[model samples]
Target: MSDLRQAARAAGTGGNGARRRPAFIITIDVEEDDAWSGSATVATRNAAFLPRFQALCDRYGLPPTYLVDWTMATSPAFQEFGRAVLERGRGEIGMHLHAWTTPPILPLTGADHRHKPFLTDYPEHVMAAKVTTATRVLEDTFQIAPVSHRAGRWMLDETYARILVEHGYLADCSVTPHISWRGTSGAPGGRGPKDYTGFPEKPYFVDPEALHRAGGSPLLEVPMTIAVRRYGAVVERARALLSRSGPARRASGRLWPATTWMRPNGRNRRDMIELARRALHSGRDHVEFMLHSSELMPGGSPYFRTFRSVEALYDDIEALFAFASGPFEGLTLSGYRARFAADAGRPPESAAGPRRTG
Candidate 1:
């Protein structure tokens, strides 16, 4: 343990605590109907996915985190839904602010959010106000202070770091390693590699400048894990082409060849499980997987529709748990983060046994 502490210090972790083994952290970004770029069924599926997902978590004695958008908070049904998650005890509620839907800050007139880009885009001043309001709403509605966050459309900037800190958000999971998003507005840059940059794959503190230099802010930037390989683009393009042929072909889940569909960056259900398995096997158990709430519903993804109905989503949750309990232990973000912090500098425990990475 002492030797492990020295290694962690050399690795720039600062404190001398043992490092925990790889673990699982599942984060569901609770989004609003308005924030979605395409269809509205995403939110409806999210409403379905949550309870069933939570039920699966409960059965396995694992807790999952839900980052709720402020827009979703307005619906009585959704509000009740959020409370229901908290009641489950295996759930953690966090803010999912959509700046556009959120009102502008007080005492700062003319700060309209209409032209601020995404519905979740909030300029600095307005962002502060929105965070405060959203935090209060989550507390009042669900009676729990959110501990983590993810930006709407994965859109965020340096200013958001300060905003999150002020609002008591311990960690932010918006960055996806080696992946960038391009749209009419512009291309979103990535934070790049962690090993070279001295960033930890597991959650750890970063300077606001390093965070911003990485193109964001200084906080515990817990990036979402993405499976990347040389054939990624080829597979994606072929799937897109097949999906475009007709709704029937896409609906059949036969759009992409099975081999191509399971390749890196493929949208198959097994691809997701592979990513989770890789994180667990790396002895860096801090795995955080994310998808827009809409991704869980039918008509959500053009290339892949894993869940055709609410029951399908439940089945996925069950499959995920079956794997986790059998191969690796699971923990919520807060639980994972706290354990990592406490065990900093210590070597990870022994791997239970060798397992396939993908």
Candidate 2:
């Protein structure tokens, strides 16, 4: 916590021009339309809804990095769409691993089978294999190696970070600040992942062993943009602190399940816009926005059940995108990583080649 505090305070001093142009990055988790069901079987039906969503991104010139899982990797339609986006230089296809679906499937007890196990629970060897296999699938499907990632459940650990770097990834956006998965539903035995309560609100080169601190690893952990309108800095910091405590987090969730996060949930467009505004005004270099592709199709997600609601979400995103795209330059996740490196006077984060175009 003290280190994160120090890092948060040390934000602007690191780079010369890093503060000159703040960026807004968009990422979508492309996966099966299971609607949070932890089942291993994948239907990939919801991918049909992505074309329209991509159209919206095109209109606003907001390039998105589609964080694909194994299911989306195998979908022919998604593959064609991803290739087209990549060829056009308008989007990136990156990996997103759902531990349960990306095989070498592990043997799990009945309880574990029912509950989605975070990669934090996987044996280091199994994690290595799953990640390698998933990465290979994306490479084969897209003919390009992916360099950006987000764990399926926001469940990241040092082991996962190490695996990502070994496989040539440059940035991972899995940490959600002012929130924690502690005591949340997870692996077979008991409670959830370690608390991310103290990670800095901005991107930092992660210490390979301890994810929360700044270090020399090439894999920069771009923490998700999470801020709520109603909660000020002090109040939100308190929420993050309390989230670290077992009884407090449980009670708070029970009493107010929806009190946290400014991720684009479409519940209120103004709230997200204001938070983005605040980030820009504060001179932060990058703001990363994320959403799951499953949420686009009606009935594919619990929060959005009707076509009307989905359309409303589209409208809200348009308004927010219009506002964000104007002042803040839009960058893909990897592109923003390059910006960070350049700001630090380091070489561009290496990719397989300049993204190939026909």
Candidate 3:
């Protein structure tokens, strides 16, 4: 705990007297429609709806980072829209790897994602190949080496973070704070997915392994904003500690953690607003909101099943933007990483964004 506190202070999360407005970042997973189905036959009709969502972000000057997957990268519809957005400087493009759908598919000892549904289930080399291939496709499609990422199926781990560092990615938005995909099948016979319980809400360089701990890696982790209401800070710290104790974890089921995400899907605007308020009060440096592109089109995602529900999501998004427009500065994922660097008294990565040198 002490080591993490020191690492965080050095990373510029806090300890300095200077105060900065918390940043807000929206990261949308741009993948094929009905992605949950894990169908090999790719479809991305949902790409047609990005401009509509971008228009809404434009209304609030919030440029989102569209995390493009292999399917979206190849979709002519998405290429057209993504090109226009980049040309107009309306948004940024980053990588989102869906292991089952991404190329260089290797047969694993266990079930494929259709049955197992975990990217960490595959070997590191397999994921490495998928990531390398995906990066090339995105660069060819958008003409910029993506510096940001969010792993598919929330399967971020030591291996995934190391892969990002190897590829020159500047930041990853895959860690869901206080959440654990533990006990889920992973790496065939290896350990389950990483547990992000007690992960920092603020961006920080991760450790060599155990991403939950602060380490010296340059690949910054921008954890998705998940908030708890009562005893917010205490609960967060305690949850982290409890994550390791078997007895405590068993007791936690009855303790009511009451976690909430800033996402618009299946949530209300007021709760989002309150979470933002609490985050600000806690001196958090950023708030991240994530949603899937499939949620934009009617009947594309299960969370948003109808046109009316999708519209309601838009309304919720508009209200969040309306609230955030005043107090927080909005940035794309890579854009915010640059800002965080500068705020920490380091040089900005670049006007466009940073590329990995190592």
Best by TM-score: 2
On a 0 to 100 scale, what is the lDDT of residue 150 in model 3? Answer: 94
Model 2 misplacement above 4 A? 1-20, 38-40, 111-113, 228-262, 348-358
How does residue 322 of candidate 2 score in lDDT? 86
Per-candidate Cα lDDT values, in order, are 0.54, 0.77, 0.78
- Tens digits of per-residue lDDT, candidate 2, 1-358, equal 3432233333354465333446779999998886376554568878888989888898888999999998788998888888889889989999999877778888655644458777768788888898888888888878887989999788888888888888888889999987777756777663358688778888888888898999888888898888633646876677677789889987765544443344556576877777776676566767787888988898787778799988888888898888776666778998988877876677653323232211
Provide backbone clash counts, one per model.
Answer: 15, 0, 3
- Decreasing TM-score order of the candidates: 2, 3, 1
Candidate 1 lDDT by residue in tens digits, 12-53: 232444333355567877765333353323244346545555
Off by over 4 Å in 1: 1-21, 37-49, 105-116, 119-122, 184-202, 212-218, 231-267, 297-317, 345-358
Worst 10 residues of 2 by lDDT: 349-358
Q: Model 2 RMSD to the real structure?
A: 6.4
> Clash pairs of candidate 3?
121-187, 206-215, 207-215
Q: After superposition, how far is residue 38 of candidate 1 from its true place, in Å?
A: 5.8
**Candidate 2, number of clashes:** 0
Work out the TM-score per prediction.
0.67, 0.85, 0.82
lDDT of 1: 0.54
